[model samples]
Target: MFDSKHVRVFDEVVRTGSFAAAARNLGYTQPAISQQMKALERSVGSSLFVRVGRGLKLTDAGEVLARHAADILGAISTAQQQMTAIVRLKSGRIRIRAFPSASATLIPSAVASIKNQYPGIRIELSEGEPPDSVEALRRGDCDITLAFTYNTATEQPASDDVFAVPLLDDPLIVLLPVGHPLARRRSVELAQLAEEQWIAGCVRCRSHFVQACAAAGFDPDIGFTTDDNLAVQSLVAAGVGISVMPSMVQSFIRHPKVVSRLVAPAASRTVAAYTLAGNQNVPVTQLMLEALREAAEEMRRGA
Candidate 1:
């Protein structure tokens, strides 16, 4: 195989038309240039140049190589430039998958911050809950995934190959109708709502709710199930049923008729950014993680 350095030297010699001139242009001695040409000729199994009086002349093979050398060098230079731009965060694309609640609250701010700071970096976002989003990360379909897990002892830890960067603790709050007696209370325990009809969220959220209710010693009377936060709030506002929601989601959108209270047992989910192990160091990915951290911190302070 022809070495890239030798090909570069050969291209320079063809451009300058002489070993001495090529050496001067490349900051190498004439002897070094001659040696590279000899090695390149050996690799290609052909003489690339011949003496025509005091100047160099291209053989038939030399002419063919010369014709392709400029294109090769140009392609190599372009590749180098693109890699440099990516490394410097001047240009790149990051694929991000976030859970719905995060997509509404944390992701918007984080995406905006990254866009403002590095306009050349393109971001593609899609909404997905954990396990699905985690699967996407493992499949290389996404570079980063914003996910959450309930901070319960029964919760399973992330897989060994996944890297989780803790962003914040998103507390679960009770959403009740304005006329509900507990609406006037500062906080409500899980057991207090056992008798009321309940509206559940996504499957994982629903599972967590059940677990929390079980911990409180009751099987909740779930009357409605939906993944839409707005729908959940709307049901509560209409006095159809009460629901529990992430404080982050409540902060982003609230129904005027629904009142939110902190949970007495203080249940929360650990929100984090997940990437395939070792991908957190990728330039664009790292920038996004940093933006998420900053956004999460701001939300924490606001809360």
Candidate 2:
């Protein structure tokens, strides 16, 4: 119940042996020091000092408090210093959850940049799909999430509890075997592949693909489903099935026998950094977001 300020004054009085001396040291009036001492005594419910002929003497309770004062003050001081370091970007930790493709592409560069710039920061990364990553963020298991949403009119907006930072748009690119009839074309239309077996990506992506195919007037015959970019490309290379994925994923993992072409009616996903509402402004979070934005910019330029 005792205030830290009052405890500080009490400790100073104990050290100096007089209210006037403690006040002089602390830059407070003697009466102010006396009032703080009285408040501290009331909080502890014990008499802390006794007058011993023009000098102050510590009572039993005062001795007990004095013994622990230095440790308490030292802990408070350490906490303050650590907080300052975090605010100044000198030291901190950021836990990030991102989807697989992004983890392989954007995350590596962004994390590396942040680590190189702020060596004292500790970054931990985990891979998950957008839904899982966002769940982890809301559960307070991660500081930031790298997620993507299919660019569609039906795509839901982020909830009120989350803040989304726009990174870059990753266009949906179709993957086909090198010798496939449409492989050499500048782009492929969804309707042209109505009879082709399909390899689907993640659940969200698969759903988007189906809807796009439906809009193009046919139901896709999906033969395999996997969230792995390398697996998707490998499947496409072997001519097992054609697939569509974010351009970022295609760029990160390319197969010699697989060719990518932009999809007609050009669908894409919006890649973003997601955080708890208001966490975007935190110094460490803000720094990581900036790194992500820069990485996205580089990818955009290269694309």
Candidate 3:
């Protein structure tokens, strides 16, 4: 981003279409422009421009250089903006962006832990689906992302750049309305629920449902598809349908008419905490992990 007078000259010459004009633009005089061009050609070992009717044309190398130079300068500007924002944010906030299931099951407990330990640090949280939240992380809008990983047959690997840390294994479960006929059964089988309409969650989250139902020898009868945990819970509460969901989603089932039962084959989602590959904010990340562990303990005790 700094240094290289030749880069400056190369950029100017390309923009103005002639060395003399470039010299006039940069106020460097024609000799200086020629000198910079010589140095640039020698350094890059490429004839970057071709002379044309009283004007200049970029060679392929020169065009490439021009494109890269613009990117480098733009990167420098972006870096300055980032540094300025960081300077303005005296106490850096730990921005936690997450998908809904993680937000419901993991964040509150993790937040409680961060609050207890890093009281001086600001904890900002946002929730959405995985793609948008991952974009937020890529854009420097969030510090961490808590997301779910399905253990089903259809589950694919996560993005390579996302540093996913295993927090817990959340098994999928079937939720039933309290007075429904299945409520009397201690544990429900996928085949048993085959005839029952399933309330679906996220699209990528379809693996759990697909694999579980496949085990029972039939594709599930999906009645409702949604991203909201509460909406699925509400549908089940109304006896509209039963749904298979990660156990962590249990945190959202509040209606008195509904109850969740762990599925028999033990389908699960591997809950993980994600961040950029080389992030230096270890302390808060550690705190968040500890909070997740504590929350896991509380959840295990059903407290």
Candidate 4:
């Protein structure tokens, strides 16, 4: 018989990006996890993952297994939930993976309430970008994942079998060095800053960067690229370049040298919380929704 434990191990390796991480999460020795994977492959008579330069990636067969494993795990969870609901069970753990902005933006206050209300329940948090977070939810790595990006909520992207609960629409803003020529302007246009140096995001995540520059009718002279938002902001503050970021980036602003301006054309982003479709509801997820509402309200008030 197929072992659910081994399937979970496989999912963990995929979720965290490494066998070491999977071992850490599953509290097993790395070799033990590797052995389990080897046994699983032997049982299935096919290799699920191939060694790729210091990491592992799912083979075609592995991909199929990964996808089905998540569904199976979700179904098992739903079964337990149905049983719990019959008895009115009040508490359980909530696993969450989300973008950096929403990790604390909508999760903290709500989690505080959850802790007070259901002291027995626990929360596990993980940081990830939107696509990865969505994938994690579908793969049963998390109960919910809060993700955000430009126009993602308005124009939901093609995602495999998952559900998203729209949370808020956030505005994007431009960051300028205080001494920038356009700093004192009441509002700025994307076109006006086209000639300025740009700090772009990591690969495969330049959607906003592309849109902002495209609106300007000229691609920006992107000089730096990194996944670290703080590093990008720091570079902007140092006048290395200017960057277009969401309003949430403002929360990290402490440099008097930097000024954040809301793009006059109403450049904004869509933020939302996602969950696996056709799965049982999690009360902690509801708490996160409430927390996000509060965060959105706070942003509006500040605006």
Candidate 5:
């Protein structure tokens, strides 16, 4: 019979793509991981991996096992959570991951509320971009993931097994230096700034900015590229270049010298929370989701 422990380790190796990484994630030594993989191969009577350049690629048998392993692990996780709920609801952990802005804005309130209500229940958070966070969720690294997409129809999770709940529409806004001529305007149309130099945060954000600009009939003259919103604000404040950013940024931090104006025609991204479809009704997850909805509603009311 195949050992479930060995199968778990094998699954981790496939998810992490390297024995060393799997070792670190699962708290095992590198050599131990290799030994276990060898044992697993002997038991299954097939080599599970092949060397492709400096990286390891899964063999046909490995691919089959990996697919089954994901379902097996997910079932195991669900079972464990259900069992934990029976023992006690107040003493458990929910792992969550989110993109940066939501981490700063929404997570704090939700986490605080959860902690205050159930002090014994622990909530852990990690930050990453939507793609990375979604990948982490798929690998069972996080229970909930907060993500956003400028185009909801195209950017949402394609897998039917993942459940997505729309939280808020984070409108794109223009950020300009305090002394800029456009700073005094209550709303800046995208076409009005067609000739101005632009600052973009990340590839995905830049793509959205470009699309919005294109819709307004101009290609932006991108002068600077960065992924840090604070740096983008600093650049805008210094009169380096104007920026297009989501409204959530203002809730986190704002540069005093930067003036924000709503974009005319109102482009926005939809922020959503994702989880395994099967986990939607899990008690702790439901509680956290409710907290997020409450926080989102408050933000909407205040805006």
Candidate 6:
């Protein structure tokens, strides 16, 4: 039988494609990693890796072992998580990753509710985009994620394993200066601002700008660009340019010099709270999901 420690070292080497990198990942010296790999090869009676020019490549035996190693390592991780949950009893940590807007608008109330009801349970939160957030969940780095997708072909979840609960529909709203002519209107038509100077924000927001403007039969004149929602509002309030921003960012708007109008022929992004489909349900994760849903409902009601 092969040792689990040796297998772990081998897996790391295969993943990194170099002994030196594997050593760094596994907290071992290059010589130590080399020794374990040799021992593993000796036990298996075959070479697992080959030097391919300047880099490393897995041999036929290595490929087979690598596939099995992933399964074994994943099983080990699941077992460890199970043991941790058992030892922690009903109180365990929930790790979450959310985009910036959701972190600002939705997560605060949800986190506060969880803290009030389950004070013993801990919450660890991180901010990341949709792809990175889902990747973190797959790597077992987080249990839940808040991600968004614009209603367009360019925006899609990278992984099929992402199971999401639709939180809210965040529509793009037009931000205009207080004295702008459109400020008097409750809703603005995209075509009405076809010639206006625009301050676009976020990659997806920019894409939406292009799509919405194109549908309105003209291209947008992007005069300024930023990824920050606050900066977008501030610039608009300064009478610099008009902007289209997500409704969630309304929570961050403190400037009284700007007016937000809902856009007709509405384009919107779907905000979803998600987790890996294979994620094990624990008490803490369940409670956190419930809290997020409750907070999202409150926000929807207020909107």
Task: Choose the strongest candidate by TM-score.
Answer: 1
Off by over 4 Å in 3: 1-90, 135-139, 152-161, 301-303
Clash count in backbone of candidate 2: 0
Clashing pairs in 6: none
For 1-303, candidate 5 gives per-residue lDDT tens digits of: 577788999999998899999999999999999999999999889999998987899999999999899788788888888688634656777899998899988899889988888887889998878788898999999999999987757777748879888899999899999998888999999999999999988788888889889989999999999878889999998887999989998777889999899999978898989999888788788888889988898889988
Q: Of the pair 2 and 5, which is ahead by TM-score?
A: 2
In model 1, what is the error at residue 104, expressed in angstroms? 0.8
Report model 1's TM-score to 2 decimal places.
0.95
RMSD of 5: 16.6
Look at candidate 3 and give me any clashing residue pairs. Answer: none
- Per-residue lDDT of candidate 3, residues 1-303 (tens digit): 234567867887888888889989898889988978878887888888888877778889888899898776677777878666544442346888877767776778778766665566688888866656666777888878776657544433356666666677777778899988878776788887778888888887775578667878999888789877788888888889988787777765566888777788666777666777666346555556567667767776873
**lDDT comparing candidate 2 with the true structure:** 0.89
Clash number for each model: 0, 0, 0, 0, 1, 0
Candidate 6 lDDT over residue span 144-230, tens digit each: 988888876666674578677788888879999999987999899999998899998877568767987898899999999988877
Give TM-scores for every candidate, taking all chains together and pairing residue i with residue i: 0.95, 0.94, 0.62, 0.65, 0.71, 0.69
Model 4 clash pairs are none
Superior candidate under lDDT, 3 versus 6: 6
Q: Each prediction's Cα lDDT score?
A: 0.90, 0.89, 0.74, 0.76, 0.88, 0.84
**Model 2 quality (TM-score):** 0.94
Of candidate 6, the 10-residue stretch with the lowest lDDT total is: 83-92
What is the lDDT for 233 in model 4?
Answer: 76
Clashing pairs in 5: 201-226
Each prediction's RMSD to truth? 1.5, 1.7, 10.9, 18.5, 16.6, 14.8
Score candidate 5 by lDDT. Answer: 0.88
Residue 150 CA displacement from its true place in model 2, Å? 1.7
Residue pairs in candidate 2 whose N, alpha carbon or C atoms collide under 3 angstroms: none
Q: For candidate 3, which ten residues in a row score worst on lDDT? A: 83-92
Question: Model 1: per-residue lDDT, tens digit, 1-303?
Answer: 888899899988888889999999999999999898999999999999999999999999999999998888899899999999999999999999998888888988998998897899999999888878888888889999988887655554477888889999988899999999989999999998889999999888898889899989999999999988899899999999999988988888889999999998788889999998888889898999999999999999999
